[model samples]
Target: MQDCFQRTDWEVFDHQDLENHTSVVLDYIRFCTDNVTRDRCIRIYPNRKPWMTEEVQSLLTARNTGFRSGDKVLYSAAKANLKRGIREAKVAYRRKIEDPHQE
Candidate 1:
């Protein structure tokens, strides 16, 4: 939890709320979402406060310094690996469910 809080780059959220919201979105996205709707969803808004908070995302345009290129590359690789692992796991899970002898 301490490590997660220290990682400011990621959106820290409650596990239950995040999981529920994401499941809802993913279920809906399978059918309803299109390019325009996706764009609208990506544009984050805060109801109680201003959207342009300095501690988070602001209206300030970012200049690409290319300083974090290595970090970005590593993150991309990690994400790809994670996705592959998830897909393989899901496939194995479905196979086991279909044929319990393989379980």
Candidate 2:
């Protein structure tokens, strides 16, 4: 991420010509592209939600695979399962919050 926003010294271009400007621009473009690729390769895991269990993640993966394989029925089923999981998780979370001593 730091590479994406790294600052470059522009003072070197003070005495440069159009060719130098073109080279600089191209280099900058390549730098940005490399940074983007690097960033994608480095997965930054977000703070996990209490409701996002392993089952939910598994279902999401299945859904993605189904969609990629162009299986509409499989994708629909996976999506429905994921939604149901989320809905149940939300309800359970709310219940836990409402009755702190229920556990």
Candidate 3:
């Protein structure tokens, strides 16, 4: 990274105005950083429910699969189970938050 910065011809932006020069410099820095850094897959769910757990996620997937299978009975059962699981998870999370020393 340091070598990249040293080798870059910053004089190329000297002819540009202040705003354009700043933008170009920032873009160059970002390009160099991106080339030198390892890419990573970071999952960020900003709107995800705080009480969501792996069990609840699995139940949700099952419900979606049942719905897609065109089986009304199966979908209904899966939906019910998902709802129950979500409720239980929420209650458990609440209890845990309210009584941190319990478990």
Candidate 4:
């Protein structure tokens, strides 16, 4: 973007400046990337699988909570629910692939 370019400190070039300019630019970029603007300019998105719906995610979260709480009954139930959700997702994916008009 124009803002990105405008923020850069442009260096003046002299008669024998081409090679020096390349090295200086490379070093500056390395410095900025390593220590200055590392992840500040990055946008992180949640990793979502194609078959993972909200229902599946919620079930998985419940399972994790149950495990963390050390409740065998809740953990078992949530694990079963997660398995069922995955099975349903696989069936839905296959049905979609087979019949495209199922949605």
Q: Give me the candidate number with maximum lDDT.
A: 3
Every candidate's lDDT = 0.45, 0.77, 0.90, 0.77
Q: Whose TM-score is greatest here?
A: 3
Off by over 4 Å in 4: 1-47
Model 3 regions more than 4 Å off: 1-45
lDDT of 2 by residue, 60-97 (tens): 89989989999899999999998998888878878987
User: How many Å off is the CA of 94 in candidate 3?
Assistant: 0.5
Q: Spell out the clash pairs found in candidate 3.
A: none
Q: What is the clash count for each candidate, in the order shown?
A: 0, 0, 0, 0
Q: Which stretches of candidate 2 lie over 4 Å from their true place?
A: 1-46
Candidate 1 per-residue C-alpha lDDT over 16-84 given as tens digits, one digit per residue, 9 for 90 to 100: 687776876565444343422333234545563322234222112121222245467655655555555
Q: Tell me how far candidate 4 lies from the true structure as C-alpha RMSD in angstroms.
A: 12.0
Tens digit per residue, CA lDDT, model 3, 1-103? 9889888887777844888888888899899989887675747589988789999999999999999999999999999999999999999999988986577
Better of 2 and 3 by TM-score: 3
Q: Which runs of model 1 end up more than 4 angstroms from their true locations?
A: 1-70
